[model samples]
Target: MTATQSGPRISTEDFRFAFRSHPAGVAIVTADAGDGPVAMTVSSVASVSIDPPTLMFSASAGSSSTPTIRSAETLVVHLLAADHVELAKLGARRGAERFGDDVHWGRLPTGEPFYPDANWLRGRVIRRLDVEGATIIVVEAVEARPRDDGMSVDPTPLAYHNRHWHVLTDRSMLPPAVAPFYAVYGRE
Candidate 1:
């Protein structure tokens, strides 16, 4: 039965509409296949733990980068800054060589693609769950590098909601426990 007439049906459009209202931090998840690098823009990144340094993010199963991501030995998740709109757009795009000359990127020792200008966590996939239409991947952080350049390290995150990009800049009010660290280390 259709959602409107049904017992337990959920409309995809309605679910998407609800999600569109929730703002999420933007990030780029990158990995390298034997041929080259592949990536996708995702806002689903979430920290799962500190003990194991784990994080999770969802990637579309239909994405061109999906095969590479699934086959890759490691993944690099770059937390974007407010100024990374262009990179966000580029990563969001489908098909074509994303690591073209225009993109400033390098390779990690493990051969995963890396973006130096953002706070990034590189890790090995520990688990994968087939959920809805996406692949929910859990990665254990093997290494993490914060943006070292003074620029773009303001902690103002690049966010997405309702099909639009936004810069979350208001950081005046922070939790007491987090404020001290926020002031000292700044945002990532």
Candidate 2:
């Protein structure tokens, strides 16, 4: 039999450091409590199934938006574009300042808050898994709206890696039709 070896168990810091090397798309998850709107930035939003049009994302329990999200029947997920770096940073901040007057947002017909200019998906909670100080929420999409400008996907999606924001650029790797959406956005 071949020898089997085990490496030393990694600490939490090491786990985080390893995760930092991978890049993830940034999204703003928003829900409306009876009072107003609550939001948080997450990089974990991912598609779970296409047949049913479902998606999932995890949120820390410490986030003020968590309770609201758990209580709400539906939530809006905004896939941010490269130009929306400020919005992501704003949502990452704690407190009422996130939905302040400075941010441009609106409520959907169903009352979920959304960014009119950004691509969004509205989903109804189908399953919620509670895991150590966090919740893993799974939702089945009920509505989806692409950017008003008719872009299928933002060519330059705002990504988070190594604890910093980044814009991925590799035209050769993109499909011909998807190439046009990566237009230079402001400072990018």
Give me the candidate number with maximum TM-score. 1
Q: After superposition, how far is residue 106 of candidate 1 from its true place, in Å?
A: 0.9
- Candidate 2 per-residue lDDT, tens place, 23-107, comes to 8999999998686788999999999999899999998999988999888889999888888888899889886587667779989
N/CA/C clash count, model 2: 0
Q: Tell me the tens digit of each residue's lDDT in model 1 across 2-100.
A: 555767766889889889889999999999878778889999999999998999989888898887887777989999988788888889977656688
CA-lDDT, candidates in order:
0.85, 0.86
Clash pairs (backbone) in predicted model 2: none
RMSD of 1: 5.8
TM-score of every candidate:
0.83, 0.82
Poorly placed runs, candidate 1 (over 4 Å): 1-6, 146-153, 171-188
